[model samples]
Target: MSTAISEAGNIPVNAATPVVTYSPVVFDVPGRAAPLEIKVSAPATGTDLPIILLSHGHGETNFIASLHGNAPMAGFYAAHGFVVVQPTHLDDKALGLRDSGHPEAPMFWRSRVTDMHFILDHLDEIEATVPGLAGRLDRDRIAAVGHSLGGHTTSMLLGSRVDDPEDPQTGDLSDPRIKVGVILASPGVSDEPTDGVMMQRVRMLRFINFDTMTTPALVVAGDKDLNENFSTRLSYRSDAYTHAPAPKTLLTMHGAEHIFGGITGFDTVETTDEDPERVATLRAMIWAYLRSALYPDDKAWPAAVEALESGAATSSGTVESK
Candidate 1:
């Protein structure tokens, strides 16, 4: 190990603090087909705890695509002193809306954006449902972490705009409440011919404009996440960081795949690169990055980077900031 603490405290990369989790926090929203369901996770004891809205990816799996997914990431964030809220977006396969012929059937990109806003707007209600969590939240210190298609949603929430002429809901969907975002294995622009094949296939993706993504965020990309269905270029996933303006950071994993060491869930077959150490490093880096981003004075981000560089954590990847 690098012998460097991730932050001012001697918190190791693999620190596992006790966490409490509550699921199926239901909310009835207007104009929504079904009730909104979410899961909440937080440290057993903490006050003024920051918030992390974890948006799950649109995977082929039956369960991980919904609020029940991303336990590995959500649990870790909660254990490390953050209130993680995960919602079951309308696009989740478990909802069985794929063949319903709804306008946003397959992806529900717009609804995904709205779901996040709803979560923020009702933080008080969300907190009141869970015991010991009612007065422990720090609403001002909020960040978002998303993976895959959920990453695209996070980018949209963090100031990435779309100017689709055919779509009526296409506009500025960014939320000012979300201070920082972590985009993992998200889609990139399709400027080149061979790049972003999936973008053309996905209706909303054809109109994505990353030039307006001014949010301060950390984009995590895997060097080996080359899916021919999406794009032939390895840099496709890092486009959020590449096209975004200053105040951005990119963490390029050395040989990781789209799953990035199985972030979707624990021991799920969807993860092609199943390295537990790599996942631990990823969770640590995410916790540290959000910690520093929400609290600018905190040195957790830099310290974690130094630890990764010095071989303190597993050699999962390299980090760069702009």
Candidate 2:
């Protein structure tokens, strides 16, 4: 392992400023079945810290699918100079909305996008909720990151749109506030289940259009993330990178699975491929990508890529860009 890519890729972790986390910062949204809940994590001391809006996946685990999930990712980003905020979308398993007869039951795709916008709209309030965090965030340099279904949410925030048949108002839901994004193990543009089980299962996925996803992003997929419940196509998850326009990067992790080495939570049963080292390196890569994307002059992305290619970071993955 090379010290070239410090603990957090190009950004070295400072032992002086420890990580701090606060949770359940509630917000009442009209028309929403339940109040919105969020968790925030950041360094104890930092000014003008960049922001990362982390969206959790709709996983099998109860708490990991909500604001309490992705501790590995949120901790890494926060420890390495980024203020991370996570929202518990309406589809959270703990909410039990799947059988509520709501039109967007199960996935609640549109509300997921709305939650991100609501977070951005009320950053001031969110900041005040956490002690010593007010006026320390760089509002202009915010990025969105999502895993699995949350990946679709991040893509939507980055410009991906859905032409939903059930919802005629499903127009462009892209937000200019999000400068860049990371999509991990998310569904791709596929017609494999044209009229099959998946079409009737996750119907919204059938209409996901990446033609207009023009924002810059990094799409990550595992070589072994084959879930029979979804499409069996090996390239199904990486299609977001394949179909999206230029200014995108794809990171294919060797031997990794849907959880990308246990990103949802530490030692959780949801992660079939539970390798801590893989999780650490993946965190570094994501941190580097977000840093470089937010600051064009930053050399973190290229340095991290070089480290990975040179076997300094690890031999577990390969990176390609358009």
Candidate 3:
């Protein structure tokens, strides 16, 4: 962890402050100058907080987890110890990850890739304007975590090899600025005929993030999840990892469903009663990923992941997410 922060504006320091939600900050990318939403978590105080860019999947995106109220699943990371921010892409729909354009890269190119790069740029902009946050944020230690389509965006950030690459800002997944790598309840990369394989037909490959990713990448999926589904997602993802040459790990929430990947699914006990095993798998994998990715030197994360693979936490905290 490095001691360096950038400025967007000078946010006041108030420890133990009640939750504060603000209107979304709309930003534009460089090339297309497309509009993107940047929502900041209200911090009580302190400059040393680590920042995380939370992204939503394809369909509908809620920057803050208001509808769903789970800590690790919701705004709890910010409450615990993280400067959380989520951006809404242009293509979010009522049906999660389902859009008319579907998997076409150009449909939401600006929203997915360009807007993402712009958000990072604004993190600097905010750091510039916010004196308190200056030197407080570990700029080089930033990490991105997303679910479903959001995970695809994160892959672009992590340097996945994409065939029909539309986002021009593709950079090294292991760039120094990013010290941690994470993928939540997302489908894996593919060479097979699975869901979300837009560039499958392509013979040439252009990486949005890239192969041989140097940053430790975490790939997670729900077992019973049928959104993009586990079989299709994992097949493509595992194949990519096998060939990429990067330090990576894969985790599956045994029998876990897809909806439980984000805040929405974790909102209520009644809403999450579909798959108990999957619920536990979601927590085990996501929790461990955070601990491991955020705190690389910590041994507990490895142990937790080990337990998940062994199928421990099967019925206790696990529930099916819709």
Encode model 3's per-residue lDDT on 138-191: one tens digit a residue: 565577776655666666676664544654643443334555556655444444
Instruction: Kindly indicate the candidate among 1 and 3 with the higher TM-score.
Output: 1
Consecutive 10-residue window with the lowest summed lDDT within model 2: 5-14
Deviation in Å, model 3, residue 204 alpha carbon: 11
Task: State the local distance difference test value for candidate 1.
Answer: 0.86
Given candidate 1, what's the lDDT at residue 178?
93
TM-scores for all predictions: 0.94, 0.94, 0.66
lDDT of 1 by residue, 1-322 (tens): 5554232223254356799999899999999877999999999997999999999999899989999899888988888789999999988897899768887888988889899999999998988898779899998999999999899999999989777897776799899999999999988776666655566778776667788888899999999899877777778899999999978999987779999877888899999988766777887888899988998898888888887787777755788889
On lDDT, the leading prediction is: 2
lDDT by candidate, in order shown: 0.86, 0.87, 0.50
**Judged by lDDT relative to the true structure, which candidate is superior, 2 or 3?**
2
Pairs clashing within candidate 1: 1-312, 2-312
Q: In candidate 1, how many Å is residue 176 off?
A: 0.6
